[model samples]
Target chain A: EDKVVQSPLSLVVHEGDTVTLNCSYEVTNFRSLLWYKQEKKAPTFLFMLTSSGIEKKSGRLSSILDKKELSSILNITATQTGDSAIYLCAHQETSGSRLTFGEGTQLTVNP
Target chain B: AAGVIQSPRHLIKEKRETATLKCYPIPRHDTVYWYQQGPGQDPQFLISFYEKMQSDKGSIPDRFSAQQFSDYHSELNMSSLELGDSALYFCASSRSGNIQYFGAGTRLSVL
Candidate 1:
């Protein structure tokens, strides 16, 4: 079975702190990995990483995929309360566009 | 900029009732995907359509069925509703081999 697992299931941090969320996967015919931030109703696209060692960034958020290790990490710098939400990681296999998602990491940034 | 659209932001149905949820893919998008997310759980893939044809399926229940129209819109028809079926149903659209943009999701509550 294709599976994606995320670590630090829940985290609490003060504003301005930095935090890292982890995702590891085991699947066949790996194609790409993606990250999303789900707030209340919908999950907004964050980044898509396909190559190892290449980092994708958006403002204070960044992510990288390590294919050799079958894992990925999402880093948030200068975190703020606005960054508190469930961070989801998913991967697509070459067979199709379907995504297998992780349990997600719930982050809470307090002021 | 257009994004995936889902209708009936919320639906309430009694056990054994039937419900139909709709989805309108983004302009020029040729694929649509359906996912169900229960409280505190990751999104689970239900099914997907490519160019109005069933392309892939996942852990969808036997009581559920879905189809895409030529207009690139889709609908998920769920019958014999169970309490476990209550969840957020999300519709996502994407161009072939690209990132998917999700809808705000329809909250289904089975009483």
Candidate 2:
């Protein structure tokens, strides 16, 4: 079975702190890895990484994939209370469009 | 830009009843995917369609059936509903081989 594991299931950080969320996967025919932020209702798309080493970034949020280690990390700099939410990591295999997701990391950015 | 749309934001049903969830993909998107997320759990892939055809499936119960229409809309029909089936069902859409965008999701509660 394909599995995705995320570390530090929950975290509490104050404003201006930098946090890193980790995800490791064991999947067959891996194609891509995606990140999402879930607030209250649905998950919003964050980033999609296919190649290793190259980091994808958006403002204070960034992510990098390490295929050699079978892991990925999402970094958030200068965190704010608005960043408090569940961060999800998902894997997409080459054989299908379906996504396999990790249990997610619940991040609480304190003021 | 238009995003994926789902109907009946919330639903309540009794055991053994049936429910239908609908999804309208973003205009011009060619693929749609379905996922189920239980309380405090990550989203699990259920099924997917491409160009109005079933393209992939994963972990979907036998009592659940889904199909994409000619207009690119999809519907998930679940029968013999149980309390365990109560969860947030999300519909996602994307251009083939692109990042998937998710809908607001339909929360189903079975009593």
Candidate 3:
């Protein structure tokens, strides 16, 4: 079975702080990893990493994948209240292209 | 861009009743997926539909089913509702191997 585990299920930090959320997975036929931010409603896609050691970044948020370690990390720097949301990591397998998601890490950026 | 669109933003149902949710994928997208999310929990994949066919089904009961209409619209149906079926149902669409875009979601409350 494909499974994803996320650490530090919840966190609280002041604005301008940096945060790193971790996700580890055990899946068959690994193809890619995805990160999403869930705010008021649906989750918004953040990044998708297919290869190892390559970093994807969008402004204050960045993510990297380590295939050997079977893990990925999402980093947020100089956070603001607007950046507060549940960060979800999902892994997709090639055999079925099915996504198995982690429990997610909740981030709260206080002003 | 117009993101994925879902219908019945809010639904209230009693046990033994049936509930149906609808979704319209983003223009030009070819894949559609469905997920359920409870409070404080990550979105759970229910199914994925591609090219008018069901691609995957998750750990959901047989009461839950989905159908895709020509890769543009999809519908999720629950034959019989249970208390545990209460959750926000999300619809997502993806291009050819691209990141998914989500809908605002349909909040289903089983009473």
Clashes of each: 0, 0, 0
Candidates 1 onward: DockQ, in order: 0.74, 0.72, 0.65
TM-score of chain A of each: 0.95, 0.96, 0.94
Model 1 RMSD in Å is: 1.0
Selected candidate, larger lDDT, 1 vs 2: 2
CAPRI quality of model 1:
medium
For lDDT, candidate 1 versus 3, the one ahead is: 1
Ranking by TM-score: 1, 2, 3
Residue range A1-111, candidate 1, lDDT tens digits:
888999999999999999999999998778888899999978999999885569998999999998889999999999999999999999988634788899999999999
Encode model 1's per-residue lDDT on B14-108: one tens digit a residue. Answer: 99999999999999989999999999999999999999999999999999999999898999999999999999999998887599889999999
In candidate 2, stretches whose alpha carbon ends up further than 4 angstroms from where it belongs are none
> After best superposition, candidate 1 residue A83: deviation in angstroms?
0.4
User: Model 2: per-residue lDDT, tens digit, B1-111?
Assistant: 888999889999999999999999999999999999999999999999999999998899999999999999999999999999999999999886588899999999999
Model 3: residues with Cα > 4 Å off, grouped in runs: none
